[model samples]
Target: MIIVTGATGALNGFTVEHLLQRIAPSDIGVSVRNPDRAQHLADQGVRVRQGSYDDPDALRHSFADAEQVLLVSSSDVTADVITQHRTAIDAAVEAGAQRILYTSALGTSFNSPYPPLAIHAATEQHLAESGVSWTALRNGFYGDLGDLLGPWQATGTIAKPADGPFSWIDRRDAGEAAAAILTNASSLDGPVNLTLPSPVTLTDFATHAAELSGHPVERIAVEDEEWIAGEVANGVPEAAARFTLTMFQATRSGHFAHPDPTLSRLLGRPPRTISDQLREQMVRTE
Candidate 1:
C-alpha cells in the first residue's frame, strides 16, 4: 500500500486524487490528524490512519503495513517544522517503510532567500540519514495566488518587498511527481527539484493578471507595519497577524524557491501554466 500524509490539504488532495486514478482505491492509505474528517477517503474504501508528525507512535502505526509512504512535510512555523519532520522520519525508519517520499523545498542556496529552505534542507538531510530508500520533491511556488505558491498572483499583483524574478508552477506537477516516486518507489534513489527553470517577476505577473482578469491591479509597496495593517483589515487575527505578515515577507524574499521544471520531465508532459489555472479558479468565484 502507498500511504499519503496530509491527504486533505489542497496540494496533497490533488496528489491523492491523481494517485487514485492509477492505483486501486483499496491500496491507498491516508494519514491525517483527524481521520473522521476524511470520511470521503474512508467511504472510497481507502484505509484512513489517524496520525500527525508530532506523534511518532501514531506515525509508526500509520506506516505499519505500508510499503511506500509519502511523508508530506508539516506546515508548522519555520522554527518548529524541522523538529517535527525529523520525528516523523525517525518513526518511518523504525516502521521499516520500503520507501519514503518527502515534499520539501529547494534548500538554502543562492537562488533565493526563502528561509524555509534551510529548514527543508535539514528535513531532507534527516530523510537521507534515515537509511530508507527516499525521494525528495523540492517543490517550488504553486500556480494559484490563494495558495502558498503565488498568493501574489491571486490578486494578479504581488504586493511585497520582492523585486527579482520568480517562477510560478502548477500543483499538478507536484502531484504527478509524487505518483511517479510512489509508483516506482522501489527503484527511486534521490531528489527532484520541483520548480520551473525560468522565472517571471511580480511586475510581469501583475501585467498578466490585469490583461487576463481585467481587474485593476495596483502593486502597492508597503512597509512591514503597513502590510500588517492591510492584512488585519483583510481579516487576519491579532495574535497570528504578525506571523501571517512574516510569511508573506519571507516570500517577499521567498520560501518557495525559483521555478525548476525538473518534475515535468518525470511527469512526461509540461505542468499547467499559471494563467490557465488562475482563469479556472476565477470563473468559479465569479
Candidate 2:
C-alpha cells in the first residue's frame, strides 16, 4: 500500500486526487490528523487513518503495511517544524516503508534566512540518515504576485525591493508532479528540484496584471523597510509582513532564481507561469 500524509490540505489533496485517477483506491491510504476532514476520501474506499507528527505511535499505525509514504511537510510555521519532520521520518522508518517522498522547498539550506527553507534543509539532512530510500521534491516558490502586489490594485503602482526573478510554480503543478514522482517511486532517487523552466521578475508580473486589469501599472523599487511598513498598514500582520520581507531579501540574493525542468519532464508539459496563475486567481475571485 502507498500512504499519503496531509491528504486534506490543498497541495497533498491534489496529489491524492491525481493518484486516485492513476491507481486503484484500494491500493491507497491517507494519514491525516483529522479523519473528519478526509471522510470523503475514506468513502471512496481509501484507507484513512488518524496520524500526526506530534504522536509517534499514531503515525506508525498510520503507515502500517505501507511500501511507500509521501510525507507532506507540516503546514505549521513555528520552530517545531524541524522536530515535527524528524518525528514523521522516524515513524516512517519504524513502519518499514521502502521508499519515502518528501515535500521540500526550493532554495532550502541550513543557512537560509527564511524559516521554512531552513526547516526543510534540516529535514532533508535528517532524511539522508534514515537509511530508507527517499526523495525530496524541492518545490518552487508559490503564491501569486497579486499577493505582494495587493497595494498595486488601488494605486496602479507595484512597489517592492529590487529583486531577481523567481521560478514561481503553481501549487497545482507541484501537486501533479508529486503524484507522478510517487507513482514511479523506484525510477528516481535523491533530491529533485521541481520548478518551472523559466523564471519571471516582479516587473513581468506587473506587466501581466496591467494587461488583465486594463490599466497602466508601474513598478517602483522601494526600501525593504518601507515596503514592510506599507504591507502592515494595509492590514497584513506585522510578523507576516516581516516574513514576506525575508522572502524578498532572499529573492534579491538570487535564492529563488533557479529554473529547473524536472517538473516539466515529469508532467510531460510545461508548468504554469506566473501570468497564468494570476489569471486563474482573478477568475476564481470573480
Candidate 3:
C-alpha cells in the first residue's frame, strides 16, 4: 500500500485523485489531520486515518501498512517546520516504509535568500540520513500568479519588485507527475526537478496577460521597501509583505530560473506553460 500525507491540500489532494485512477483504491491510504474532512475519500474505499506531524503515535497508526509514503512539506510558518518534518520522517520509517517521497521546491538551497528554500534544504538533509531510500520531487513554483501579476486588468500595469525568470508549473501537473513517480518508484532517487521546459519573467507574464485580456499591461519595478509598504497599506500584514519581498530577492538572484525537460519526460508530454496557466485563470474569472 502507498500512504500519502496531507491529502486534504491542493497538491496532495490531486495526487490521491490521480493515484486512484492508476492503482486500486484499496492500495491507497491518506493520513490527514481531520478524517471527517476526508470522509469523501473514505467513501471511495480509501483508508483515512487521523495524523498530525506533532503527534508521533497518530502518525505511526496512519502510516501503518505502507510500502511507500509521500510526505507533503508543511506550510505553517508559526510552527517549527523542520521539527515537524523530522517527526513525520521518523514516524514513516518506524512504520516500516521502504521508501519516502517528499515535495520540495525547484531551487532548494540553504543559501537561498528566500527562507522556505533553506527549510526544504534542511528537510532533504534529514531524509538522506534516515536509513531509507528517498526521492525529493523538486517542483517548480505553483500558486496563484495573480498575486505576482497584481491587478493588471484594473490598473493596466503589473507593478512589483524586479524579478528574474521562473519555470512556473501548474499544481495539477505537478501532482500527476508525483503519482507517476510513486507508481514507478524504483527508477528515480534523490532530487528530481519537475518543472516546465521554459522559464518566464514578470515582464514576460505581463506581456502574456496583455495579449490574453486584449489590454496593454505595463510592467513596473518598484523598490523593495516601497513595495512592502504599499502592500502593508493595502491590508497585507508587514511580515507577510516582507516574506514576499524575499521571494523577489531570491528570484533576482536566479534561484528559480532553471528549467528542465525531466517533467516532460515523466508526463510523456510538455507540462502547462505560464501562458496556458494565465489563460485558464482569465477564463475562470469570465
Candidate 4:
C-alpha cells in the first residue's frame, strides 16, 4: 500500500486523485488530521486514518502496512517545522515503510536567504540519514503571481520589491508528476527538480499581464524596507511582510531562476506556462 499524508490539501489532494486513476483505491491510504474531511476518499475504498505530525502513535497507526509514505512538508511558519518533519520521518521508519518521499522545494539550501529553503534542506539531510530509501520531490514555486504583482490590471502597475527570474510551475502539474513517480517502479532516488522549462521575471510577468488583459502595465521596483513598511501599514503582519521580503532577496540572488526538463519528461508533455496562469487569473478577476 502507498500512504499519503495531508491528502486534503490542494497539492496532495491532486496527488490522491491522480493516484486513484493509476492504481487500486484499496492500495492507497490517506493519513490526514481529520478523517471526516476524507470521508469522500474513504467511500471510494481508500483507508482513511486520523493522523498528525505531532502525534507519533497516530502517525504510526496511519502509516501501517505502507510500502511507501509520501510526507507532505509542514506549512506552519510559527511552529518548529524541522521538528515536526523529523517526527514524521521517524514515524514512517518505525512503521516499516520501504521508502519515504518528501515534498520539498526547488533551490533548497542551508545558505538560502529564504527560511523555507533552509528548512527543506535540513529535512533532506535528515532523510538521508534516516536509514531508509528516500526521494525528495523538489517542486518549483507554485502560487499566485498576482499576489506579488498586486492589482496590476486596475492600477496599471506591477509594484513590489525587486525580484529576479522565477520558474513558477502549476501545482496540479507538480502533483500529477508526483503521482506518476509514486506509481512507477523506477530507481529515482534523491532530489528531483520538478519545474517548468522556462523562467519569468517580474518585468516579464508585467508584460504578460498587459498582453493578456489588453491593458497597460508598468513594473515598478520598491525598496525592500519601504515595501515591508507599506504592507505592515496596510494591516499585514510584520513577520509575514518580512517573510515575503526574503523571497525577493532569494530571487535576486538567483535561487529560483533555474528551470529543468525533468517535470516535462515525467508528464510526457510540456508543463503549463506563466502566460497560461496569468490568463486564468485575469478571467477569474473579471
* Per-residue lDDT of model 4, residues 49-139, tens digit only: 9999999999999999998999999987678999999999999999999999999998999999998999999999999999999999999
TM-score of every candidate: 0.81, 0.95, 0.98, 0.97
Tens-place lDDT per residue, model 2, 1-286, is 8899999998999999999988999999999999999999999999999999999999999999998999999887654988999999999999999988899988888777676888888899999999999899899887555676665767898788767777788888988988898788355788899887977788998898899889998989889888778878989898998887888788877888888879999999998877788788668767
TM-score ranking, high to low: 3, 4, 2, 1
Model 3 lDDT-worst window of ten: 145-154
What candidate 2 gets wrong by more than 4 Å, as runs, is none
Ranking by lDDT: 4, 3, 2, 1
Residue 89 displacement in candidate 1 (angstroms):
0.8
RMSD of each: 3.8, 1.6, 1.0, 1.0
User: What is candidate 3's lDDT per residue for 22-111, written digit by digit as tens?
Assistant: 999999999999999999899999999999999999999999999999999998878999999999999999999999999999899999
Error of 1 at 252 (Å): 7.7
